[model samples]
Target: MSISEQEVRHVAHLARLQLTEAQLRQMTGQLDTILSYVDKLSELDTEGVAPTTHALAASNAFREDRVAPSLPRQEALANAPQHNDESFIVPRVI
Candidate 1:
């Protein structure tokens, strides 16, 4: 359950973090503590517990699908900041 300083540094690098030596040491300790807590959780007995998909009892309350009228093209584009004859204009991505 212990995390080494090297491992902490590796993780920080992967996460694009600029951790100092002192920060790395602190992160290593914190990661070790978190792993220890997880190890403790693994030791818990759950012999009779049923697996659950959600914390709350959830059911899908579905409604009927029906055809609905949509706004006309002109009305839909009325409030747009910028639009063309067919669609809204937006900044080019590439």
Candidate 2:
């Protein structure tokens, strides 16, 4: 499939992009090349292949979760430049 200059212009407008004539031409060619490559990929034979999210097998390497004592609040706030009774007092952000 090929993308036209008009279609590229429409897409640029939708994306709030200000493309010059030269840029529009370049983008149209790039999009055409990308679509052509995708079309070629669609011609591959994979009748029984399962769809996969990634090319390589991946799994989370999780450690055993155990309850641990947390740092005391006073110790955690010891280095704070400014603080109230329970929390840090940073400058107000509108």
Candidate 3:
């Protein structure tokens, strides 16, 4: 699971990253360690476990949707900076 210098260079090229020699060497070791640790986790047996969205049990906690009265047209348009007969007026765009 160790990443080589050449592999690190290839990855950098794909990601459009420009890493210094020191950074590339450092990242290669770090990424190799992380992948090796993940490889260890892959050895666990969990054939019968159900997939879950969260570690703890969860349920929807939604409020009921309801319709309510709306403001009158005059009240809704009272603070408009500019307006035409029945609609707000706005500057023209090309």
Candidate 4:
């Protein structure tokens, strides 16, 4: 598929871009080239090929989750600027 200068102008207008006459012509040619390459790729045969999100094989690198002991409430509140016996105090919001 080939791209026209009018189509390029419309796209530029939609994107809020102000293009010079030269720039519009350049973009039209560039878009035409890209569409042509896409059209060429559509002619390839891939009946048995599996679809993939990435070009190469990928695996998760996350570590296994485990139950762990949490910090004591007294220790956690030790560094607070304002706190009662249990929780930290903060300025009231509307």
* Candidate 2 runs further than 4 Å off: 62-66, 71-85, 88-94
Question: How many residue pairs clash per model?
Answer: 0, 0, 0, 0
* Count of backbone collisions in candidate 1: 0
Worst 10 residues of 3 by lDDT: 82-91
What C-alpha lDDT do the candidate models reach, one value each? Answer: 0.91, 0.93, 0.90, 0.95
List the pairs of residues colliding in candidate 4.
none
lDDT of 3 by residue, 1-94 (tens): 6779899889999999999999999989988999999999989998999988899997899979989898888887888998775788889999
Per-residue CA lDDT of model 4 for 26-66, tens digit only, reads 99999999999999999999899999999999999999999
lDDT of 3 at 5: 84
RMSD of each: 1.9, 2.8, 5.0, 5.8
Residue 78, model 4: Cα distance from true site in angstroms: 18
Model 4: lDDT equals: 0.95
Q: Let me know the TM-score candidate 2 reaches against the reference structure.
A: 0.71
lDDT (Cα, tens digit) per residue for candidate 2, span 2-93: 88999999999999999998999989999999999999999999899999998999998998899999988898789999988599889999
Q: What's the residue-level lDDT of 28 in candidate 3? A: 92
Better of 1 and 2 by TM-score: 1
Residue ranges of candidate 4 with Cα displaced over 4 Å: 61-94
Ranking by TM-score: 1, 2, 4, 3
